[model samples]
Every structure is written in C-alpha cells, then in structure tokens.
Target: MNNTEFQAARNRPGVERQSFKKRLSDAKFLLILFAPAMVFYILFEYLPMFGLVIAFKDYNAFKGVWASEWVGFKYFSYFFQNPDFLVLLKNTLLLGFYSILFGFPAPILLALLMNELRSIFFKRFVQTVSYLPHFISNVIMVSMIIMFLSPTSGMINQIVQWFGGDPIYFLSKPEYFRTIYVTSGIWQGVGWGTIIYLAALSSIDPHLYEAAEIDGAGRWKKMWHITLPGIVPVMFILLILNVGSLMSTSFEKVYLLYNPLVYSTADIFSTYTYRVGLLQGNFSYSTAIGMFNGITSFLLLYAANFAAKKIKQVSLW
Candidate 1:
C-alpha cells in the first residue's frame, strides 16, 4: 500500500501496527547495503578499542593484554611529570592552531575563486595541478621539501644566494619548522579540500543568484548574500572535524621532516608516543600517552560542537 493507504489501515478500528519481523523484511535491502560498512567499523574500529586496557596495565608482550600486570595510572603520571611534557604540548598546540588559522580558510577561498572562474578550461587545469600534490606520498613530499630547502644545492637557497644572501638550512632550524610544515600541508591538501566546498556550492539553488541579479546585485553581492550562506553549514561541519583532531598531528610527515635540530619545535605527542611505545618498546607508557591524546581530542570535539551550536546554531549534532 501507499503511505496514505498504510496510515488509513492503521487508523481503522481493528487495524494493528506491523510486527518487527515485517519491518525487518521490508528493510532487508537497505540492511544488506549497510552491512559492509558496519562490518568494517566493527572489525577495525570498535573491536580494537579493547586494546585500550594496556593504557592502565604494565603491558608485556610475553604475558598478553589480559595477563599484563595492573599499573593503574603510573604511566600517565610519569608522562605528566616528564621533562619533555611542556615542550611537546607547546609544539603540538602551536602547530595545530597555526594549521587551523591558515590552512582552514585556504580551500574555502580556492573554492570561491574557482566558482567565479569564467573559463572552464583554465579552472580544470588549475584544479588538476593543485590536486597532483595531494596524491604524492608523505615520504616523497618530505623529501621534496628537504631537497628544495637544502642549503647547498636547494632551489630556494640557490635563489637566495643569487640575490647575495647566505644559504640557510630551513629544515634544521627550529623556528622555521612549523612554518614549513603548515605551509607545505596547505599546498598539498588545499586543492583536494576544495572538492567538498565546490560540491556544496553546486548544491545551492541557482535561483537565489538569479534573484539577487534581478535586484541589481553584482558578482560580489551575490557571493556575499547567497553563496557564502549556502556553504556556511558545510564550513562549520569541516571546522568541527578539524578541531576534533587538534591534538593529533600528522605523525608520518613530522617524523620524516624533523630531526634532533628541529625537535624543539617539531616534536609532538604522536611522534613522542611512537618513540617511547614502538621504538623503545615501552608499551604501557606509550598506550597511556595515546589514551591521553584521545581523551583530549574527544573533549575538544565536544567543546567545539557546543560552541558552534551556541554561536552559529550549526554543529555536527
């Protein structure tokens, strides 16, 4: 029956609601469609959370997870009191803050500019060139950055020397590390990031722009009045996702780019955890650090969602 007929049948004096089995049979196709994603998350995400017990245990490979001796919060307290705690926290927060400050708006601006482009050929070419960098592996990306900024034969240093300036080792200096990392990240991902905003832009009703034009509005006015409002929800959702990861810096890129010389500014929680946990085999200590990072990220996500809901009435929820 159609929805109206179904409702009419339900409203009849002796009619009864459908059984759970009937509902399940009716939704079987959708259930089948959702099965793969449910299975994937169960296997790779939720199932692995059981390993978190190691954060409170003195984990031993020989004893396995459950058999490991209970250490309570020993590792967590040790990390809090460690000499590198403050520095690592500072570096991680600064990198994340700077990335959001600069990196977040980059794709929005690019999407807006691309939307305004009159020539499809030129726009496609620009997008193609921009997206190429994102597909480059992290190892290759870091290697390129190192080579391009090398003091001896690097392109940037060579240009500086040609202008009668000294060759500076960019990656070796602590002060320059964050800038290089954040800027390179923006360049690498901005184009790929624009794809979502562009999709959002396309979904905006074209009639809004037409109506604005009919009222003697120009390109900028249409964008300001219609285009931006249409995409504000998408932007806020992405912002919330970014804030959730504020404490989780890219381990692969940072590990590849940083050395002892730049560790003062480049060492973050993820890299520190890797060294202590995997390299040094201090499993319990590493697990504690990871747990702390995860907890902080969860709190940030909650706070951001709360603030966004209050301020803009837009949130992940």
Candidate 2:
C-alpha cells in the first residue's frame, strides 16, 4: 500500500524526488566551488578529531595512540579538583563576558552612527580607518599597544604626566588586563563586524522610512522605530555565537599580551592547555583540559541558541 501511494505521488507533477545521479549532475558547479573547503575541512578538521580520544588515554609518544593505556577521566578529575581551577575559570569567563559587553555593542553603535552620516566621503574615510587595525599583525598590534601604554615614554603616560599625575605601567598590573584586552578587541573588530549590521541595515526597506516621514516621524524617531528593529535578528544571532565561546579565549593574543606579572587576570584555558601540552609535554593532561573547555563551550552555545530561539525567535538553526 505504501509503495503504491508513493508511486501515485511520484506520478503527480512536481512530486518526484530527483535521482542521485541527476541531483549530482545538477549540483556539479556548486560542488566545484566547494571542493577546496571540503578537502580542507576533511584534512584538518575531520582527521584531527580522531586524536580527541587521547584526552581519555594515558597517551605515550613511543607507544602511539592506540597502544596507550586507557585512563578514563582521571585527567579531567585532576583539572576540576586543582586549586587554580576557579581562578582560571573566572579569568576566562570575565574576559569573554567583558568582550561581549563592550565589543558586541561597539559594531552596532558604529554602524548606526555611520548610517546617519550625511557625507559619503567622510563615512568611507572613518570606515577605512576603523578597519585598518584588524589587518595589523598580532605581534605588531601588541607591540603598538605596549608602546602606547609605556610608563616612561608612552603617549598615554605622557598625557598623564601633563596632568601632573604619576606614570603607572598598565601592562604589568593584573587589574588592567581585561580592560585592555576588551578595548583592543573592540578597536580591531568593530569596523569588520559592522559589515553584517550594515548589510542588515541596507536591507531594511527605504519605503518604510518614506512612510514614516509622511506620518510626521523625524530622523531619530524613524531610526529608533525602524532601523534598530531591522537589524535585531542579526544582533541576536551574533550574540548567541559570542556566548558559545565563553570558555575559549583566543590563545595567540592573550599569550602575546600577558606575562607572569599579570597571570591572575590573564590566565585562561587555552593558554594553560598550550603550556601543559606543548611546553611541559603533558599531552593527555592538556588534551583533557582542551576537551573540557570544548564541552563547556558547546553547552554555552546550545543554551544561548535555545534561549535566543525562545525569547526572540532567532537562532543559528
């Protein structure tokens, strides 16, 4: 009866599924375009995932991955029970939270402000200038930050001295790490991030603005009532994605910027994992730490997506 009904549906117009070979032929151009990324993901992403099992093993370099002893969750238990666990957790969360609090809004506010600009030339200039920092090498960017905040000959300290205040080393103090990290992140990413919001803004119908004008709405009112609402779905999507990475701060920037003097506020899971795995040769221990961070990040992402879908009807799905 099911086969007869399926044959009946297939016989009807537009009810038949394409055969595999036909679908493959139809999608050949798209497959060609996607081939490089597919190969790269298979090589670097899917292949490396096999090593995640090392997190559960007493991995040995000479004995190899499969021959290694199975240690179960000992490394994970050790990490959770470690005295510095809370501090590491706190530092990672605070940095990610601060970044979301400050950095997330910077792009939206910038895009809105730029949207209101009357002169195309000036707006383009501001955008070009804002985007330049993102292209700067991390090493160069950190070096520039160090120079600008230098206590003795730095531009910031120079301003402080002009006000008759003492010069303090910003980089050496633990108190300043989160602020500097978040602020620099905003500076580097704000312009680039705005591209999406700007595109969202552009998609908002011009007819809506015209209708608002005819209804006695001013520029501010139209922007408040129309423009902001237009990009809200995009905002929620980005926010949810940001929440997903709360436990995994970028290792390169943090490692470059931090020293032993600022470890209290600067130490995070990625850096700790790097030190344990690469520097100390504790492969299994560090892999466990990384796997733990990955799990927490996944949970955070899922929770955020769930909440966003419930509250705003907007999510990655």
TM-scores for candidates 1 onward, in order: 0.91, 0.94
TM-score of 1: 0.91
The C-alpha RMSD in Å for every predicted model, in order, reads 3.2, 2.7
Task: Rate residue 293 of model 1 by lDDT.
Answer: 91
Please give the lDDT score at residue 147 for candidate 1. Answer: 93
Candidate with maximal TM-score: 2
lDDT of 1: 0.93
Task: For candidate 1, write residues 1-317 as lDDT tens digits.
Answer: 89999898788765444555678899999999999999999999899888889999989899999898998999999999999999999999999999999999999999999999999999999888988899999999999999999999999999999999999989889999999999999999999999999999999999998889899999999889899999999999999999999999899999999999999999999999999888999988988988899999999999999999998999988
Candidate 2 lDDT for residue 115? 97
Q: lDDT of all the models against the reference? A: 0.93, 0.93
Considering every candidate listed, which one attains the maximal lDDT? 1
lDDT of 1 at 123: 95
Which residue pairs clash within candidate 1? none
